[model samples]
Target: MGELDSTLGAVLIAGLLAAVLHGLTILQTFLYTQTSGSDGPLMRCLVLFLWSVDTLHTALISHTLYFYLVTNFGHIGVLAAPTWSIIVAIYLTSLTGIIVRIFLAYRLFLLCGRYRPRLRVALPAIVMIPTMITFLTGLIFASKAFIVRLFARLDTFSVYLYITFSAAALADTLIAVSLCVLLYRSRTGIEQTDSLLTTLIVMTINTGLLTSIFALLCLITYSIWPLKFIYVGMYFSLNKLYVNSLLGSLNARKILQAKQERSTHDHRRSVRSTRFEVVSEPASYLSPAESITMSGVAQKESFASTSNTLHQNHVPDQT
Candidate 1:
């Protein structure tokens, strides 16, 4: 217990640091909304959950290491006893992280997977089985005595740690590979909403690859100091995912705006191209009823001319 006192300090410091970074990231998100008038409650919620879990994870791992390595490290006078409260914290953090992580993976699958009613569902189900198995393996790996009992070749706790890392790596690899297939196939059908879809795809791939590499590194101690500085880096996704969902929401808005503008332009062009006109009535010809009303006009004009000619001939006869 006394030998690893400084290691406990190191763990606590790292946890505190992670917690502080998470706080700052969330604060930044709030500031961005205040300044831009573009708020995202869902994204904020996801990030908040992620960061909180990571912090809780740090606490649980820290407590567990202290109990196992310090309190029960073959101490002479003091003995380790089961504390109900501590056990609850352990279950809450470890289980919660696994559950949330799986939830995020499922969300990603829905976002990127091909669209066929049957295949749409079956793909996620296939990915889930492997993911759950890997997560269960992680829990088993955490219990040093239990796992050692099952596998004799792995004598030390360190070997089981490697197994845990391997399981995580395997799960991450599955997610990465599956998503890559989704991304490749997306080019065939509907036009993707650019920024949002790209972000979703890229992050899915990045997180998958990065997490896998981290797990792989856990196996190789020759690596740089086991990344113990981050205090359960698994939940760090919360901070990074903060802006991702917001960007997706904004992307949707832009796409809709573009569609509306295009529709308006097309409507105006159609109207301009149309040719509508009023019919003109004929004025040169009269109808049968109008011709009857006009019959007296020609007769009156002929009588005036004949009367003038007769007056001139009568004057000649009188002379």
Candidate 2:
């Protein structure tokens, strides 16, 4: 009943996206308990928040997209009870997700010396304060204009939608810029240990960039093609990437630690062997005394030094 067609293929795709988001939500929720540490709590909370909201947002967007364009269900129309409310929820959720994402971006940005100042200024407001303000503001207005109360007054609420959505888009753009700077700075010196961190940082930046673009597109039109339905699905995959990359990094670090421990033990053994001395005294205590020197150990040590060149190249490069 909306100004859109009902194609079954679109509905099917929407369903698939919804399913993906839901699954990601469940996985993240289950893994959250295993995550622990000082910053881990915060990151896990952010992830959980994003995934949970994404599940709802994606489901709503998919259904909205389906009803309007994908499926000619008997109950399809603007007059559908949840239409405008779902739009408000999606708009709010998208913005919240962006805030959480920017928090992640800044967390990485702090590791890049150049962007720490920018993060210190921007991240706190975006993640902690402004999100609550924006969500509360939208809820206040949207509650007053619930679909049932204003199904006939839909046109009037369009202005509010534009206002809230534009605010969210602007916030996201600011975040994208901060992350772009961070990623640009991180490219050269990122160590293998930090590879996962680098990936999340890049993914956060790219996701923010794409989300901002999509939000802008939504502002420019009300068409089905530019619908905000796919944001949740995108969030799901990116979070999975973030979690997996970090998890692998942690595993690799543990393995490396174990290898270092074994190498240390062997090095100590070799050092002891290289300096080893076997002391001996001939038969009677007072009659005759003889000392057997560790020339064998000394000779072996000299041979090792000449053959290996380990000591010669052990010093670090100052530059």
Q: What are the runs in model 2 whose C-alpha is more than 4 Å off? A: 1-15, 28-95, 98-102, 105-119, 122-137, 147-152, 186-201, 223-319
What is the Å distance of residue 214 in model 2 from its true position? 2.9
lDDT of 1 by residue, 1-319 (tens): 4423323444445445545654554565455444433435654465456545545644555564566457666652222232232334434434543554565456545644354667667767776665566556555544543433322223344443455556556766776776666655543322222323354466557656766675565455313443232323333332233233333333334444455456446544543332111112223486544544444344334344433422221101100
Which residue pairs come into collision in candidate 1? none
TM-score of each model, in listed order? 0.48, 0.51
lDDT of each: 0.45, 0.46
For model 2, state the Cα shift of residue 207 in Å. Answer: 2.1
Q: Which candidate achieves the best TM-score against the true structure?
A: 2
Model 2 residue pairs with clashes: none
